[model samples]
Target: MSAMTGELAMCGASVETLFEESVEPVVELVLGGQSARVALFGATVISWRTGARDRLWMSSLSARDGSAPIRGGVPIAFPQFADQGPLTLHGFARTARWRLADRKANLDGTLVEARFVLARSAIADTQGWVGDFELRYTVRLGVRRLELELQVANLGSAPFDFTACLHTYLLLDDVRNVTLHGLSGLEYFDKVAGRDRDEVNDAIRVEAASHSSGDVLGQRAEGFVDRIYRAGGERSPLTLQHAASGETYSIAQSGFPDTIVFNPWVAGKKGTKGPDFDDDGYNHMICVEPAITREGSGPIRVSPGSTWAGTQTIQVL
Candidate 1:
């Protein structure tokens, strides 16, 4: 591990690298009363704190020794999403070690930025996928907002098609007390039911009943939920509001055409939890992911020497 630290004399913003004995290095960014932690193992933002509260939820059983993918925070899904392709689940970017390309703070120190790079060589195996590629991930932290941008550049001579996403887990007072706005009138593919359906309500609430019944307006979400909403070329921001705390988060994405909402309400047959998730974890966290692939739509193609990028910005409102 490199013994390095960056400081800004103008303000309270600073970037420091901490090394653990066996695990990868972790980068900490602090500005004013807000802070964020990034682990190089997957270039994953494991923690983000603002207003003295943690807005990102992390699973208590998540592995910290780079043994497995961290269960929470903003995990980068690249080259493939889930079992959509022949590659591993969510691709290898979430588990592969990333290189810290750069880190710095602005002149006033009100914002901090860090860049991580992953090349084709870093990936041990690409599952027979051809095409040399490089990924650049940038994280910007402000007092009340966090921005994540992913750039995929094709360096090979041939064009390649792939899918990607920013899997973000948001912590909430209670998943049932929250309503997600801005997905109204759109169509979504429900993974749990393996069907396509239309969203009728302007505000989407967690419901225990199946949404296929057309009467999911006021119900609470209790069962396992996994749906991908198509938002092609739409720039409208989605808002997640916690009823108990009055805390609202505005989630917006660019270059990512789909949004996936997921929650494992009941883990197993009897609501038993998985190894990396708590029995009650579903009650406190929800994932509103920004993705680049749509149902029945194929992967995105990038020409030689061309680059594809996506940005997801979350703000406290």
Candidate 2:
């Protein structure tokens, strides 16, 4: 799968904006057999496919009109994560329209980069997070790999604090057959149980791996999970092994010390309720997010004129 030829090619890939399902502008980045589609509405990556096989899970019930946050793919949670802070839900970055400041298809399509900028203005003022901040989100598409970097630069006179995460919703063949490795003995804050505990084993089942309730900070662990694991000093990639499909995906991150492993299996309970993602849809989606929160790893305190950045990379194995 070579780069698109003729006038359609720039550098080596095709970088273009087209109005697809909504009137909002969406950027399409195609590199060889790999492609990613990002919408300016939230600078969200709605779709990512390699070899024509869908690698991302996007909710069919999600709002496509930019009225609300698209419930799937990768939604950038910034200034706030979840309802933990004063800001609304996942913050304005996921709902505000961003400007595509730069696009480059470099090195004969081996690497493609697109940078999105979110400035402090109505987005921050309306969301009650008023500050002179500049967020530069860069998405790089390469051979069998996708890297996402979020750079936050504080341009305000006073220092501002923010908690952010790449709320990535990954598509899987089956949630039951999924097992995560690398978080063997790390402590995690179980949001469901409202307590903190340690992972006693290497294999993390969708439910309780042990019969003891306190072992996992709960009694008879339910069918879903919404916990944040502290990846303390562990820089190795977290591998998600899909038993059924016999495929594996490696997730690595830097500058983010927390990892959120969530699978709202049959979404119905409280915070897990995703109207866009039905009960059955939960069977095919898992969120392995690299994040920083006020509760777990603490919020990012960016000093005035200082810049903070984090990158999450995904590789298919």
Q: Model 2 over residues 184-256: C-alpha lDDT tens digits?
A: 8888887767788888878876743322333234323456677788763264588989998788888899988
Q: Give the least accurate 10-residue stretch of model 2, judged by summed lDDT.
A: 210-219
Residues 1-317, candidate 1: write the lDDT tens digits. Answer: 23234355346677777898976689888888999999998899999999999999898877889998888888899888877878888898999899889877787767888899999999998888886899999999997999999999999999988888888999888888999998888888877677788888787776554344432333333466788888723734899988999988999888888888888675522334347876677888988888976473457899999999989889999
Using lDDT, give the best candidate's number. 1
Runs of candidate 2 exceeding 4 Å displacement: 1-11, 21-23, 122-124, 207-221, 268-272
TM-scores, one per candidate = 0.91, 0.90
Candidate 2: pairs in clash? none
Each candidate's number of clashing pairs is: 4, 0
